[model samples]
Target: MGDAVGRRPAFLLSVVVIAVFGLLSAVANNYGTLLAIRVVVGMGIGGLTIPFDTMAEYLPQTQRGTALLSLSYFWTFGILLVVLSAYVAQQNFRLLLVLCAIPCILSTLVAAWFVPESPRWLLAKGRSAQALDTLRRAAHVNGHPDAVSLFPLGMKLKAEEPEVKSFAVICSPQWGKLFFFLSIVWAGFGLLYYATIMLVTDIFAQDPAERGEADGEGVDIDYEAITMSVVSEFVGLTVVMFTIDRFGRVASQVFTYFSGGICVLLLCLFASADSTSRNLLVVLAFGSRLFMSTGSCVTWTHTAEVLTTEIRTTGHSFVNSMARVTGVISPFIVQGGLPYRTIGVILFIASILTTIASFCLPETRGIALGTAMSQDSTTAKERTGTPNSQEMSQSPATVSDKEVV
Candidate 1:
């Protein structure tokens, strides 16, 4: 839908869906009602790729990696805020839901009023006038009105617009290889990321000494452990934000996954030895989280960067959907009473496989976003010294525009 219509509309619709459903969830009377509403909320959440795609398209290539990775700070802070809310609400589920909805509502207003449609999407869809106008507006905002003159008044994509569905285009031979490896990376990260967090929470729950008595009330939630986990995420994001653009996406993922897998292996060893050192377990858990957080951030930014603008949102959403599937299954693995070593082996294998898969993907650190699938195919062939006659014939202006933007 984003690729077909425009990124801004899809983004606005997503925010509205989340805000409306979230508020509705606050008033849900029963568990089933709340669950159904949350499903709709999840659908809204799924469309979040639109905004990420929008940001990726609008930003300059030099700053794109750092900017996109920086967005992860909001996510980390959001988690911290949720934890804080949960602590404050103290079982008042209604208040908690309302509090969560507030951000969605505010974001909806901001997106609707402030955010502009992606000029890249406009150009891809044969709306050059709008695309140029958007660029002019952006240039004006940045106090570079003169740069608007550098943008072509009536730009056209060198590659023809794709007629088939976005999915069909990405599934074609040209993009299929990249998509396949990305899917594996996303699914593995999803499974390992959530599973590690849940496993850590379960471990904390098992140690009653960490859980204080609450008289006749419910068991005290371990907010301290949760805070530590969030802190680890922040630390990981801090490191990746500085290094991702410098090292490139593939290298970042490889490092994080390999290091994280080692942490998981150590966790397995500690569990198998039946070590009673709670502090050691906590440290290992934090270490796993730090790496997982960094790896997941790189995976997301890489996915957005690699796909062509024509299929950016669709391709990203597909890979993210695979992640969502594994995310759902993570709870069962962690809470299913499986032995620690078994869970550790599953995560370790996933991390290592993802690490290997990261090598299969091309690095997309500073490359301008490809407007069409053919551009991507041409680039790939160029890398392999097999550029076709048509790709070799593209005009200098068309090529220069890609680099300039």
Candidate 2:
């Protein structure tokens, strides 16, 4: 949808549609009504990345990775806030749903008033005059009036691009291996991260023995464990925010996944010990959550970086859908009739796969989104022309303005 309609409209549509669905969901009368509303809500959710696409267009190359990763802070914080709200409100889910809609409505208003359409998308769609106008406005907003002239209006380039099966393009010779690797990394990490959270709740639940052993002396539920896990995730986000621009997306992701995998193994080993230490278990869980959050942030940033703009929105949707699939599958592994040790083993394997896949990803540190996309498209063409073509060096970043209209 972003490919055809442009990011700004798609983004606004997402927010407005979601807001509408949120309100409807709150008042849904039956399971069937809620289910129908949620399916429509899911379509709106697919456009969630459109804002990121627009954000990338406006940010400096140096700050782009951090900016992308920072989006997760809003997401993670929102999750924590909602959980706390539910706890405080005595689990009034319907009311909470209504409340969430207000923010989406407000955000839609802000975006409609403030956000400009992406110049790159405009260029892609052969709307150069409008693209230049958009760039000038952006430049004025950024206090760089001189930069406006750098993006000439009506710059022409090849106007014809194919729209094959989006998946086929992603899997063609140029991007196939990289796409596969990212899919594995995304799916595996999502599976383990979500599965671990479910497992932790079960692990820390009140023991039936304690409940039966005394009169009104059952052990208090350690809600602190949940708090600690979320805190660790925030800490992880902070770490990524600082180091991602320095160490680059690939290194940070590899370290997070490898270290996280080790933590998972340690958790399993500690569980098998004759004298299991609760403190140690909690510590390991915290570490795992930290790395998982960090890695997840990196994955989101890197996936955006690696794909060309031509296929970016579609690619994001595809990999994100895969991650969501894992989210669905993970509960079965962790919560469905399975031993705790068996669950740990499953997560350990998933984490290891993620670490390995991270190794296959490219470093996209300071590359401009537009330049990266063009470079990859050029490489794809060259490779198709000659199967043995040596990898082409990245061309000097240039803005072409001379092609025929």
lDDT of 2 by residue, 326-390 (tens): 98899899779777677777788888889878766665655555344333433323222222222
Worst 10 residues of 2 by lDDT: 388-397
Model 2: residue 314 alpha-carbon error in angstroms: 1.0
CA lDDT scores, all candidates in order: 0.77, 0.72
Per-residue error (Å), model 2, residue 147: 6.9
lDDT of 2 at 104: 75
* Superposed model 2: Cα runs more than 4 Å off: 145-165, 207-210, 213-221, 268-278, 370-405
lDDT of 2: 0.72
| List of clashing residue pairs for candidate 2 | none
Candidate 1, residue 235: Cα displacement in angstroms equals: 1.5
